[model samples]
Each structure stands twice: as C-alpha cells, then as structure tokens.
Target: MNPRRKKRLLFATVLIGGVAAVASLLLFALNSNLDLFYTPTEVVQGRNDGGAKPDVGQRIRVGGMVVEGSVERDPTSLKIAFQVADTGPAITVLYDGMLPDLFREGQGIVAQGTLVEPGVLEASEVLAKHDENYMPPEVAEAMGKEHKKMEYSEGQSGY
Candidate 1:
C-alpha cells in the first residue's frame, strides 16, 4: 500500500472515532442531568432515587396529596409552603412562584424541584389538580379507604 494512502485512511478512521465519542458523551451527560417524574409512593419507596442524591440540587417530581390546612402563602414575599402526603409520610415544600389555579388544601399536587434541606423540598414548579373531580390516583384511593372506614363504623353504631 502507498504510504500516503495509509496515512489518509488512518486520519479518517480517527476523525470518525472522535466524532462518535463526542456524541456518546453528550448523550450520557444529558441523561444523567435529566429530571424524572415520580409519584409519592415511588419517591418514598426509593424507586426514583436513581442512585442520585435526593437533596443535592437534583431536579425531580414529587406527587402526593396536599395536606389539609397546610397551604399557606406570604402575600409580601409570594412564598408558599405546604405539606405533601402519601398516606405514609409527609414532605414539606417551599416555593416562590405562582401556583396553579387548582392548588388548594386537601388536593393532589406534583411538585417539581429539588430538596433544599432535609425533609424540606424547594419546588421550582407546582402542578395541581388536573380537572374538576379529578385527583391524583394515590390521594383518591387513600380518601376512599378512609371513607369506607368511617361508613363501617357508623353502620356498626346504628346496628
């Protein structure tokens, strides 16, 4: 083989390899930094931890019921605080942004952000009720169970 031809072939091979490497790197970085959605159960069950630190500025979505009487807002600072519950544990959320119109006490919400401190989540966005009579399946199911219990007790008393 001619020396010049050999040199050209080697350069072409290296250039192609370099391009492929760069593309792979970019994809990996993007995937690593992506924020993923998780329901309250998933979050508490460690399903969406992805081996990433839950409180180290990693973007995430946490869905749960908004605890009744836990919603509060500061008119001056526009800061909002609320409690999100999964029927197991509750997480406190702090956000400084306009909340969704459907946000209210005793409703379901999906907060997107990172944990700013232990047991305290700082949300960048807050997603509230999807529609009238619609709630997060988790919250609705929990409420249903509670309703049944109460009804059963009332029936027993009457009997």
Candidate 2:
C-alpha cells in the first residue's frame, strides 16, 4: 500500500480501538456502580419463587420500614442489626457503621449494601426518612397496595 493510505489505515485502526476501549470501560463502571432497589417482600419472594435471587456480595439497595423492636446494637462496637419490613415480609440487615440520627423503628429507610444470603443484607449505608411524612418514592412504589393496608391499620390503631 502507498504510504499515505497506510498511514490513514493505521489512524483508523487506532481510533476504533480507542473507542472500543472507552465503551468497555464505561459499561464496566456502570455495572459495578449500579445499585438496584428492592423491598423486603420482593427479596424474600424472589429467593423462594424461582426468580433469580441477587447473588451474594452483589451491591443492592433495600427499602422498607424498620421493624419495631428489631434494632440490636452491640454497645461496644458500632455494629447494629435490624429488620426491615414491607407490608408482606421482612429482612434482617447487619451494618457496622454510624447510623443516621433519624433511624428508628417503623420509619422508612433504605439500606444499601450486598445480599449476604437469602434473608440478610450486609449494609454499607443506611438512609432514613428525613421527615415524618417523607417516604422514598421507590419504597412507596414497591410497597404497592400494601401501603394502603398499612395506612388503614395505623389509622385504626390511632398511630
């Protein structure tokens, strides 16, 4: 091939290779950082209903109400374990860090971490509702009709 044509071909090859490399890097970053939100009911049912359960150690987010009377603290360490529940089911979460001041039972929360097993989440981050009336949109949506039932029950009990 002529020198000019050879040079042009080399340039095109390098450009294509660079583009592919960048694309691959972007995909990998996205896959690693993408955190999906699931409710406790969905997590439990997904494990038992022949649906694909999240692989252990895969990053994810779980959203629900903190189950009343489920909070346990080590007192010595920062480790805390609590159960989060949607209207249907509950999942236990273990976290070893400072919890938000607003974190409390019966309040809405989102825990982000990995699924350590079928019923437990090893949370790295915990987010609580900022206000009494505030609930994460994703949590509300995932709760589905169960939210209405909870509201009805709470109203009846005068909570």
Candidate 3:
C-alpha cells in the first residue's frame, strides 16, 4: 500500500479503537453503579410479566408501605429490622443507621441496599416520604394506590 494510504488507515484504526475502549469503560462503570428497583412482591415472586427477580447480593431499591407492627429495633445497637410490603408478599429490610423521622409503620419508604437473602435486604440507606403531601408516584402505584394517599389516622397500615 502507498505510504499516505497506510498512514490514514492507521489513524482511522487507532481512533475507532480508542472510541470503542472508552465506550466499554463507560458502560462498565454505569452497570456497576446501577441499582435496580423492585417491589416486595417482585422480590418474593417474579414480576407480573415474568421478569426475573433480582439476584442475591445485587444492589437494589425496594419501596413499599412499612408493615404495621413490623419494625423491630435492637436495644443494644442502632440496627433495626422491618418488613416492607406492597399489595402482595413482604420483604424484610435490615438497616443499621438512624432512620428518618418520617419513617414509621404504615408509611411509604424506599430502602437502597443489597439483597443478602432471597426475601431480605441489608439496607445501607433508608428514605422516607418527607411530608404527608409527598409520596413517590412509583411507590404509590406499585402498592396499588395510584390516586389514594396513605392514611394512618385510624391506626391502619397503608399496606
């Protein structure tokens, strides 16, 4: 091949290779940081459309209404355990940190952490609705209360 043609081909090859390498690295970083969301029922069973459940040890965010009378705190430590449920089955979440003030039974919450067991999550962070007027639309809809707000005035559980 001519010298100029060889130079141009080499340059093009190097540029394409560099772009592909960068794209792969970006995708790897994104995938590692990705956290999938699932409902308690979806954790216990598969999705309604038969999607596979989150694998054990995978990072995820699960949101649901805190099951009434399900919060249990360890007297010796800051660790707390509670069951989060949607319309169907419930999944237990163990968190070892200060829970948000708004966190209470019958309230909606989202826990971000890893699935340590099939139906359990070891939460690294727990988030609760900041106000009565605010609820994550996704959580509300997943729990089968699309338009209704969570009410606990009569000592009832939102789930």
Candidate 4:
C-alpha cells in the first residue's frame, strides 16, 4: 500500500476508536446516574412475584400517596419514617433529613433511594406535591391504573 493511503487509514481507525470510547464512557456515566421510578404497588409486587427482586443497593424512586397515620418522626434527630401506598400495597421508608413542607399523610410523594429490604426503602430524598391537585406524573399514572382496576372489580361483582 502507498504511504499516504496507509496514514489515512490509520488516522480514520484512530478517530473511530476514540469516538466509540467516548460514547461508551458517556453511556456508562448516565446509566449509573439513572434512577428508575416504581409505584409502591409495583415495589411490593416485585418483591412477591416469585422472581428476583431488585438488588438491595440499586437506586430507585418510589411514588404514591403517603399512607395515612404512618408518619413518625424522631424528636432528637431529623430522622423520619413513613409508608407509601397505592391500591396494591405499601412500602415503608426511612429518611434522615428535613422533609418538604408539603409532606404529609394522604398526599402524593416520590421517594428516591434504595430498597434495603423486601418492603422497605431507605430514602435519600423525598419530594411532595406542590398543591392539592398536583401529583408526580408517575404516581398519577399508577393511581389511574389502580382506579380502573377497582372500577372493573366493582362492575364484575354484580354478575
């Protein structure tokens, strides 16, 4: 092969390799930072579905209504615990930080953390709805499905 042709080919190969390497690195970084969102029902069902549950340390977001009368606080510290519930099931969460002012029972919330146990989440962050009519989109979608299921079951009972 001619000298010029050999040099051009080598340059092109190096350029392509560098691009691929950078792309792979970016994807790896994003994958590590990405947190998947699951409803409280989904989290519970996932644990009981007779399949492998999520890895204990994998980060995830759980969204649902804060179960009424489930909020407990440690007066000596910023620690708080609560349960988030959908129509399917509930998951207890432990958090050690100041909660958003809107956080309360019977309100929609999204907790980001990892599942430390089958039905427990160790939350690193807690987000609450901004207003009476506002809810996280994931929570809304999950609750909508729950509502439909309830309606269907009620309709079937008459038969």
Candidate with maximal lDDT: 3
Q: By TM-score, highest first, what's the ranking?
A: 3, 4, 2, 1
45, model 1: CA deviation in Å?
A: 5.8
Ranking by lDDT: 3, 2, 4, 1
lDDT of 4 by residue, 22-129 (tens): 999999999999998887777767634475556678899999989899999999999999999977778999999989999989888999998898789999999999
Give the alpha carbon lDDT tens digit for every residue of 41-141 in model 3: 99999888889999999999999889999999999999999999888889999999999999999888999999999999999999999998777666876
Off by over 4 Å in 4: 47-52, 147-159
With a 3 Å backbone cut-off (N, CA, C), the pairs that clash in candidate 3 are none
Give candidate 3's error at residue 142 in angstroms. Answer: 2.1
Per-candidate TM-scores read 0.70, 0.86, 0.90, 0.86
lDDT (CA) per prediction: 0.74, 0.89, 0.91, 0.87
Candidate 3 lDDT: 0.91
Predicted structure 2: lDDT: 0.89
Candidate 1, 54: how far from true, in Å?
A: 2.1
lDDT tens digits by residue: candidate 1, 43-149 = 55454435433545667877778889888889799899998877566778899988888889877788889867645779988888878667666456544554222
Clashing pairs in 4: none
List the lowest-lDDT window of 10 residues for candidate 1: 142-151
